[model samples]
Target: MTETSPASALLEVTDLAVGFRTMDGQVQAVRNAGFSLGAGQTLAIVGESGSGKSTTAMAVIGLLPGNGKVTAGSIRFDGQELVGLAESKMRAIRGRSIGLVPQDPMSNLNPVTKIGTQVAETLLVHGMATSKDVDRKVVEVLTAAGLPDAAERAKQYPHEFSGGMRQRALIAIGLACRPRLLIADEPTSALDVTVQRTILDQIGRMTDELGTSVLLITHDLGLAAERAAELVVMHRGEVVETGPARQLLEDPQHPYTQSLVRAAPSVAAVRLSPGAFAAPASQRLHLAETEPGSGGAGPGGSAVAVATAAGPDGVPPEPAEQNYAKTPNIVELKDLSKVYRIRGKAGDFHAVRNVSLEIPRGRTVAIVGESGSGKTTTARMLLKLITPTSGSITFDGVDVASLEKKALRSFRQRVQPIFQDPYSSLDPMFTIERILEEPLKTYKRGDRAERAARVRELMEQVALPASMLRRYPAELSGGQRQRVAIARALALNPELIVCDEPVSALDVLVQAQILKLLGDLQRDLGLSYLFISHDLAVVRLISDYVCVMKDGELVEAATSEEVFQNPRHPYTRKLLASIPGNELNIDGELAS
Candidate 1:
């Protein structure tokens, strides 16, 4: 274990003010952000998007984007000031004394190079290893980063690896030089909960073994509370709260922190009804005991299934799904399967295997799993993006697989898709109005004036300002972009919408708002959603039914209540177990 004491300040940042010169003007991205990390201590800077959590990290490392400059502040790393350090000196310290594991591995790494080569480059850049032994050291670090078959995996490119494996590769590179301090910026945000635990555990073990200090920047309060010792809550470029993680979580003084705690699905109280009260503490069951078909009774001792809901900071109780008992099936899949043949001598890959599911009209059915679990593939097939090798799909009793061009186009208007990454999904060159209007134009729903009217209507529906209609996708935040995507999906008034990880990329607050918006929209529009995501907690929030997938097969399928109360499959159980802060409740009590 590493020694972490208040007496030893490994990193001391004081009154840090950072700004960026944009087309609009100087935007103060980080203002008066100050925190101290004791030697071997883990400090988390938690905030929503545009809250300057990442800007502070970038300022410390001298890696701020173009036009970004430190306006005021003192960044002292090991008693040495680094605020005005030259590029050469900063480069020497970077990766040598301070390593960085960025948010997205795909963007951070070279796509054409092999994983081993990337790790070797880090070691070589910092002179950590000689040319003769770099290859061997690469494998060692990759293995230490928790990549299986490190020797062989090192030779493969990032494209060959899964999202988790690629992140592990980035971890290998980040820890290759064994730096004194590591800055992990949302390192596991894009990953599933199980893979997230593995990656975080690997970092913990490495940091402990090397006695390295960690600066964790993330939007996940639950993750920060569990992993970090000290927490600094930032909002609108200012630090709102800074103290012991447990203390802040249990008795938050700041309103923002309190809202964060309430919004967090892991710790939020289960809202039994719109204004329902929770059951007594005596009636609540432990996390381990709440499995599928566990017969966990609710407030009146009825057999009502329960789920977590948004309410005051209290113990999460089991809330029941919304009443959709009379709704008919909008989509039905029977024995759906998809197979693809590799170019090499290897056998075919079964992306989806004998999966059968139903999405009732005006109900949400969520598919939850890790990457390559065939969740997205199933959604793609449902959207008719790809033809499945076998099985049948019926959209409102019509065989979707047998649809011709005109009929397929008509089917598309009734069923739309909201992708995972809104930044990439929306066209960059087009204005928000154009982007939303394109769908109506393609479907030829109305004239230009009518389309513009619909665009304004969509803005109102998604709660975006009408002034934003002229703004481009680049100007919008992650949450805003997703809202635009949702608006575009709704432009056709589609009955069934395929939401693929729609809220996964957003911050917790934005995520909560988006979930609320979806729920509200579902109630108002009677919209049925085929929701696909890796986040089970979010699934439990908005989904009526839950389907757990693994290795291209449906491991478990049940009502969200049944799955949460009594998960039957081992894979489902593992996924539930892997939820961040699963062991800790809102009251900071550890599950016995």
Candidate 2:
């Protein structure tokens, strides 16, 4: 990496300030934030969700929303001032001189247009290719961006491609003109670890080949520390610290930066002692007593016991020979599979194939895999959202497929879902209070007065202020919205909750907060969670046992400690290896 200096820097921002015109008044989004990126160097701005990282990047790229403006500062790219550059002039520099890979590929790529056309548009817009040769150029860029079958992939719409593929398409467009600078804003935030690594690797290779300076904006501290040569820590609207990536991460000077390192799952997991979930024997919840004549295992080898905890005196508890087999499973999937029939020549898509797992009562069992690995399909089957093809889902010793209308309704009350995107899962048209109360009303659990009181109680349970109950989902932040989603899931007093990528959309700090909240809730309510996620770092923190899936097959199942410390399967090891900054040697707790 080239050392950056004021004179030699390819992109330099000094004393940058950005503001947005809101209903209240001008609100400062970025304040005096400054950073410099040398040619062929990568610099990252890391912070929580509301921090000014994205705003600063948008300001530099001349892509701020209509309501936003660069109030003050100088953005000098390739020795030219850009803060007050004309719109026409900025347009010329945007695609031709400075490329941008936006955060969300689904929203960035036009759904109706073919991927090839999108790439071709950028090449044509920048005069990089003509109408006759644009198609070939499109294929060339997509292939360079690491898309397999580039020619066929180019003919598909945005919706047809997977998340990683769409991101590659965006990369193809971003680097089509081989710009001197690239701005990647949370480019891999929504992708799984393996795919995230692949995308970042591809970016590194492409940028290196073109000698492009990159300015990356992300909330992932570990990823920033691993991928960037220099790091800029942002807090609120200001840059708090800047230094070499390794030096800054190993010894973060700013309190906020320190907290971020501590809160990061990959780093924090190191501080968690083995058997972190183990509680005192007295506090452990025994969901069921040992059954007579039934040695230890439940039907079909489903039941498993919670990890034995230490006694009150800090002595390890004695192991019961038949304890695990005697325990009752809260939920079980036996040879469960789902097959979807395709309309085209493609016959049937086997989404889940004979996947079997058990979620013990009052414990979290996470199902983890890359996208299309059948993790989500297994979750949906457990929730009874879709009919299984040849297997059974047993909930509380009863087959879910055998549940009648009344029993199904009762089952619904005991098993609730917390979806991935809290903003989309919540009802935007309704207030928080109504969102929580609607479930109660549907089940006719209580009177209006009783329901109103329950709503407040649920809010307090999730550590949210009661004052926000009247506000709609639009009025709340991402974490706040997730809290509301959790509150609604708990309003019914469910014994089991299926959390599908609950904290994947949240930042490191908020992800830690939400995970802590879920842990506390489980301990207090004795709830069971069938957590589904693609993030192994997060799964290590919350899950008691983990089931690894790949291509609709269960590859490995073991305790969290076994999965993380001594993964037996090659696929599981690969997933662990893909985690960013997993090799860091940080010690001691940094989170509050």
Query: TM-score: which candidate is best?
Result: 2
Candidate 2: residue pairs that collide: 296-325, 296-326, 297-325
Q: What shift in Å separates residue 418 of candidate 1 from its native position after superposition?
A: 1.0
lDDT of 2: 0.81
lDDT of 1 by residue, 1-592 (tens): 2334434788988899999998899999888888888766799999899999999998888899989999998999998899999898999999999999998777888999999988999898889899999989999998888787798888888988876688888878888888899999988877888888887887788668878989999888778988998899999999999888877888889999888877776523332211122333322211121243442222111112223332236654434423343356789887788999854437998898877777777777889888778998999999999999998899999999889999989999999999988878999999999999998999898898999999999999999999999999999999999999999999999999999989877888999899888878887888888999887777766776677888787767766665877788788899988888765554444455
For candidate 2, lDDT tens digit of each residue in 166-234? 877887888899888989988876677887888789778766887888888888877887899999988
lDDT of 2 at 38: 89
In model 2, what is the error at residue 516, expressed in angstroms?
A: 0.3
Question: Candidate 2 — worst ten consecutive residues by lDDT sum?
Answer: 287-296
* Candidate 1: residue 13 Cα off by (Å): 0.4
Candidate 2's C-alpha runs over 4 A off are 1-3, 130-140, 143-152, 161-165, 267-317, 320-326, 585-592
